[model samples]
Target: MTSIPDPVEGPGASPAVPGAPPPQLVRSPLSDGEWHRLHPLTPLLRGGLFLIVVIGIVFANLRDRLVFIFLPWLAPDIEDEVGEWEGAGGDPIDFIIANNLYVLAGLAVLAALIVLVAVFYTSWRFHTFRITDDDVEVRSGILFRTQRRAPLDRVQGVNLTRPMIARLLGMAKLEVVGAGADANVKLEYLSTANAEAVRADILRLASGRRLSAAGPAGALAPPRAGRVATLSQTVGREITGLIEGPEAPVTELESVVHIPVGRLVASHILSMSTLGLLFAIVAIVIGVSQGVTWLLFGFVPAIIGFGAYWVRSIVRSLRYAIAPTPDGVRITFGLFTTITEIVPPGRVHAVEVTQPIMWRPAGWWTVRINRLTGRSAADGSTDQFTTALPVGTAADVERVLRLLQPGLPDDERALVVQEGMFGPGETDTFTNTPRRAWWIRPLSYRRNGFRLTPDALLMRRGIVWRKLVILPLARLQSIGLYQGPLDRASRVTNVRAHVVAGPVSPFLAAVDRDSALALFDGVARGSVRAAFTDRTHRWAQEETSAPEPADLVRGAESAPAGASESAASGTGEDRT
Candidate 1:
């Protein structure tokens, strides 16, 4: 691949315009106690949160806004307090009693409003995410300061979210995704313009070069924009593989799944605060007399969330396209606001075909990756990568998997899925079965369960949501050759496979241990052999492979007496 331009070394580069001394670095707002001017999109995007809270506050103080307007009407009813009695035309004692409380309440409201404005100002000035030549930096907080600097090498990709407000303003929020010390550190929420700049800068740094935008103070990148043609290409690619030839099959991909907006809205209404609901009910009663019914206003947020969700569902998933390119996998979609994410194929750790219960009949599956860097705020603090595939078909899944893990099984990219909804006796690459009284019934109705025996280990999950886990020798984290007291009579043993958070069998449940050692050695070797230097790609493609004897199930030895703790990471998400 040709090298990126050397902004520092290019001869034509604006030769330090032979003027005064080269400009020096300016102080950051954090140091100088000045607010850093942020992306213009910042206010509009975050304004949603404030607006939510503010509306509540304003409603809570409804009587206050209505005060002056109603004061004229209320004043005369107040025992002729201020105007008549306060002028000594009425009883002095009654006058004081009537007006004093009102005067004090008004004074109190003015104080509160002033305090509210100060808070809003400070909050707006605190959080910031900037792209630097070397890394992405987040400087946030006011009293107790927090600054995060994540190396560009640690950056996974810029996750762009166009919230309702961002859509209105043509802005985007950028997440600087990297594995934080505990999980992944993400510099969240940048303006659209700055978001693009930061994304480009990160990409530029990922390329192992300092961009001209880098100065003592990192320069803000105008949002790195993908061309409309580029987006169309990405769209086509998301449909097909870009980097890989268009021969791979799509596995667990869903092309068409109708979003139930009404259901979503109803669910939200059902989930609202009891107090809010009661208020709406009260407003309905008041509407019998008052022309202005507050009940109507109560539905605004639900409507907004409803619209936002539907729009997100439609636009985000609309004509969604995925393709393999020379650099990595590119995904494109959106009706009103377009977003395209390019993921370098090699950075992908693992790929999975996730079929949630709701998406089952619709044949929708979400394809997600455990990538190198970045996490969403939702999935704890670490990098959690996901591409919710509206289309979940085996063919789509295979195509995506190839892009994520190219050459995983080079023989053939597509594998026919064997039907075994009732039990675990299906394998595309190897014969899988649940013999030896191995399966644990998750729910009596569904055949999904955990299974472990000396011969082969598998976690059979799914009836409504089906998942079959077949852990062969190569995938075992460490074989637990143990049998519980009750299991002693059954003469069965279990093995646990430890896979890290990134790709490759992350957090799989139990599996038996026949022919596991071979599988373990093979996968471990595969990991070592697959490690590459280039670490980047554009498009991904298709291939189909059938089960081979090499996909063996290795039996495990009993667990060491105290090896239980070591198995925690590989155990089920249900801690109980």
Candidate 2:
């Protein structure tokens, strides 16, 4: 691996030319393994904007008081009004005015402003992050210091987020997602170019690939430009993005699927949440008309909250796209505050394709996955992180799935979407529940079944809210079979494939007893075989010398049959 050349060194350097701009100095912080400070404007972008807004509100409210104290000549002519206002409260401004401490007050405000500026500047200076071959680390503190690290090998994904304000400033944030809850480390407010460059570096390192002799393409930071030129370029790009769409990061491949605006809006409108909102409105109108006028207080706020949530959901999905990259699948979404998430190969534990009863008419479906993002639901944005395809047609779902699970064979991919999600039990390849199990799930019994493939296990269930769950053999942690009293009497069982904690549930209910036994046995042996042979965690290595799809399946099939049966029947559980 060769060190990246500094912009001022070797070929990057140029002789001075009269009347021409000087050469720009570009630095590659990621390659240096040294602690680097965030953007100088980080504090302002993070919290100073909110502080400015708060100050503006306070200043507006105290406008008259300020005028009376500093500009008596411009004060309102209503002396009685001033007296009445002063008499109503023990206000600090009144005390300052009464004591004629105007100079002191001015000094105090100026001192506070100075202190605030110092805090912001100090905060920006103290907050620094570094990237190395093994981990990404961040350190921050004023008095109570804190440090966080995300190991490159354990990284689940990397996300680059550009909030609206930060986007306009040509800045973005990078989050290196760890495998455990609340384990993510973030580097907030880097230049857009640097953020993208750092993101590429992290993913590249995590993929077990060294920088090539020529240096990774994304490692070369753009030449730093003059402030005026930089600002103009940032604004121009932002305006263009608003009209067209966010520009694809250099690391992203061409999108595998594109979700149209019309389709996205229609999907949300037809959702059960929207239907519930409509019903609530109807009920509220009826209640108000029938002498319950007080309902307005609650109804108004409820409507606003629901409308805001709905609109936000739609907006966040506006520029949604999924693409394959060298390191993983890159999912990009959001209209204004764009986010690009890179989910590396083998990090995904499970995949699910679902369709609500309402969506069936329009042939729309959604795809979600089980992956450790190291963020809990409290983050509020976890849903966006887990959703691979928010809403799309069957073909769109297939394309997204192929990008997400590249090892899945072409035939298996077709079976997953066509048979696993939409096929009837009789004609599909899945081993479906027997008719006797109909009593357990009357409506969905015909659709409920499980299919075992070489690389994954597909479980299809639900009629009104259809779902197809795909759990890769390599990621399966454990397998269990359950038979409640009712299931025992019906000669049926439930099978659960446990993986990392995530939104997708990989459990199939009401499976025939014998079929469940076989599934348990097969998965027990297959998971072990797959785990031993799985090299996807170091995806770059696999990419360079990967076996054929058929060979992978064949490799997983060679596990001893006796070991699987014994493991499955003895404890009624198999731990991978």
Candidate 3:
């Protein structure tokens, strides 16, 4: 560990020279001006040479079979050889097959090996990466040379992924998830140790330090006080577990919450992915065993597709964890494609917690969020919103909730949050969907509702997978009201809240038309009030002083008595 160096008055202590280069946070991994190539194994790890070889071999086999079967037309001379074999009392088909098989196999193997070697060599020769003070650059491609650069400052976070094979070989891929869609840089197949070091170096550079103005010591400003623990510390704890006990508690440095592997597996089993995979497997097994070859055509593709999706989902979420950092909240997870995402301070737009009916008994919930960062290969495309936590207990949920919504009112925080999630219409100040909405969604109409808090907008929907979205009013971007033909006939409207790039933002579905407008008005008013309000994202900096519950109770009590009574009359009983 590098200790904090004592104060020293040196060249760096004085203001930088008029034209001198900026002080580097650390030495660049590359030479000042040299173009460095990637690890020699990059081609095998990332190049499509294996795919090319497989296709080449398949085509070779097909060509050999066609030539043997159609020799009479394809090569009229071969017909004479077949006729000679029949004249010598050997079957023509047998003669041709026996003589051609071995030669074709040898030629196919030779051709495949040659093509694989050429492609792999060409890819390796062209691929290179370079690190500089301001950016990390990667250049690759044989036919169409391409270069990608991620500026150190624009780099949001770094992801280090080790697939099962790569992990066994001590190799990993490092990705810098940049601020722009095209700026992201991926360094494929570096030694694991080098990847981790590069990640730390990149983060330190991106953190941007300055000399402390407070003290004569003039120490360099360190990175975030609560930065996520490094990969080495996290891996050390896993290794320590074998000697310590089964499932050693996460170290204080690693994370505040650790999703148990058992919970993760069980949650996955209960998900739609597992169901789809099971259906595909059953169909494929029955199709192949029953000799219904046509069924194979339909089920084979589904089986492969769903099986891949299932495996990737599980790989991407293994060892999921959320840790605090000065830059923002750091999320690290994945078994194979390990991803590290930093939700920078004040960047979160909204948060959603959902509990499926099956998980309700286990008290497990999945959390997701909306933030401002652009799409990333590590984070995934913009459409697939990353899960903050796939499965967590109510307490775990509360911890993450507080982390994401630091400005949440302190008093009755748990009660208020619970009310938002799976609470009845009367819980807190929630405005229930009118009974008339039953026509649109009979199973979950009563469950749809909204609650406007001083700091956030809470909306809940769904019956089977209860979804509760908490949109911090201060982060509200825009609000809209939609009325379909059915909604119009039913006198209902869907109110949607818009945030930056993410899965669909929070929405109140199928509420009474008048109530929807009123809700929209409330949201508009709340957004106006929250505009320009400086909210802190650091969890530690939030105010935690407890006030009387009455202070929060007032929010619920302030809900219009008439609306509450109207909802009460509709439900045939008061919900509270």
Candidate 4:
């Protein structure tokens, strides 16, 4: 291969030298290697209890048989006595109860101790993890020997989960959520402080900060020690600056917003899941009264568990706040194992602001984003990193909008973005579902709407849970139009924007059929324009100024297709 001379480094050169071949990265070995073993208690904490329980159960079932067969031989004293019993009663259980009971108990205890020590020791010896500047790697398994690695840049998020026992012991498990599905790296049972420090390092590295593995025993240095000061120091410096006005230190990051604990608690209590809990309670009562009292045992435990989970989840999200950092947005929250994650700029793919019907009265909205990251949140409904704002006011929504896409024209927000989130009726800048749609979606028809802006296609829907999905034209992967039999009868079509896979693909339903066709054509054309004009996803990262979307149609080009007349005709109005 003809090797070209190294090109002068420019805007986006590879970190490694271009002309020279990249250095090969190798995994640390198993024994006498740089790889670090998990906390000594990890095996016991993870599986030792279960093994003990299993062994106890087996011992309980086989005690009499074991005593009958081995007791006489192992204990010569029992041999003479059991030989006498062979004449009195040949029953194994009788022998176990009379002569060999203590012996059996002793044997069981000894066997359990042996198995527990053997299993836990082996497990502890096998699991190992290594942190290099470029990647986090974990090697596990006794027989199969599985090794998994996640590159520092590809790590989307890191979760430090401390289970009930783990928390009590002040230990935690670190899960590095990666961009690729196969790149999950988990380091279980690190000291709580160590886990937190490791998580910070991962995020710091992912945010493009350099980390030196030349520290003690090849461990990455504490992220805050020298690279970045600890949170307390940062805050203290800010306070010190404010007091010494003349010598106020320059602040690198600004705290933009913080969610109140009271609001978080209330919003979680009134969440859509509250309705589900009520229904569950009602079902339990009805079922029990109807001679299905047996169901109470299962249903009650499940209901309690679900409620507890939600409560913890709510508490975890409490004290949620967003701040601007050099790398991107800094998200910090959590009741116990507080998390601090840096979402690098330009990574967000889609955005959704929604409010449940009950919550609308309270002026609360939840903001979530779709990023090019790992799987959806724990519930599997949305991306794990989706919820930027679990609950907030209109102003909060605006703040988030400004942060995500600052380049959007100012007129666009006033003309559509704000109103599209919680507006009523159609305007020159917005289009709503036809009146005929009310017959099919009686409660939500008035709220279903779409607005086209220079940069994004915004869709709003729902009465109980209001939703605004913002899909940037440049990020669109495909556009689709669908009409079922009922939609055809109602003379409406659904327009779906297929974006990158995560949570926030935008879909607008019950739009007038004629308008839908026109909207689809406009979006397809807009995407082509956006591809050339806007190359960067992050507004701040744009190198070249592309032409702004100058003449985006505010609404669909065509009007509703005789929607009122069709409703009056009542041919298929009540089909739904």
Say which candidate scores most in TM-score.
Answer: 2
By lDDT, highest first, what's the ranking?
2, 4, 3, 1
Q: Candidate 2 regions off by >4 Å?
A: 1-27, 63-79, 210-223, 248-253, 542-576
Better of 2 and 3 by lDDT: 2
TM-score, one value per model: 0.54, 0.88, 0.64, 0.64
Instruction: Report the lDDT of model 4 for residue 239.
Output: 44
Clashes of 3: 0
| Tens-digit lDDT string for candidate 2 (1-576) | 233222211222122422211112113544346567788779888778978998999999988776766686886674566777778769887777667788898899889888888988888777877666678888887777788999888999999998988888888888999989999999898888778767877777777753342252323655778989988899889878876866554556567787888988899899888888888888889989998887777788988998999899999988887888877888889989999988999989999999999999899999999999899758877888889999988999989888878889998998887788887745678888899989889998888999988679999999989999999888887788888899989999898888887789998889999888888777776665576567776676434455564464454356466544343321235422
**Global lDDT for candidate 3?**
0.62
Clashing pairs in 2: none
Q: Lowest-lDDT window of 10 residues in candidate 3?
A: 567-576
Write one digit per residue (lDDT tens) for candidate 3, span 1-576: 233222122313222323221334333333222345555567666656567677788778556445646564777566665556556756544555667665776687789878977988777766776555567777777777787888766665566656655554446777787666556688887755556656655665455543231112222333423324543544564444323421212223476677877877788788776777787778778888999788788777877887687677776676677877655666766654455555555567778888888888888988888764545545545433357777888778888877777778666467555676758745446677778768777887777888777778778788898888888776776667888888888888888777655653576778778877676656654554454344333222333465544443344246564443222211111110
Cα distance off (Å), candidate 4, residue 341: 4.2
How many clashes in candidate 4?
3
Candidate 1 per-residue lDDT, tens place, 134-190, comes to 555656555766767766565555555544444444455555556443334443354
Residue 136's lDDT in candidate 1? 56
What are the per-model numbers of colliding residue pairs? 106, 0, 0, 3
Arranged by TM-score, best first: 2, 4, 3, 1
Pick by TM-score: 2 or 4, better one: 2
Question: What's the lDDT for all of these models?
Answer: 0.43, 0.78, 0.62, 0.63
RMSD from true fold, candidate 3 = 12.0
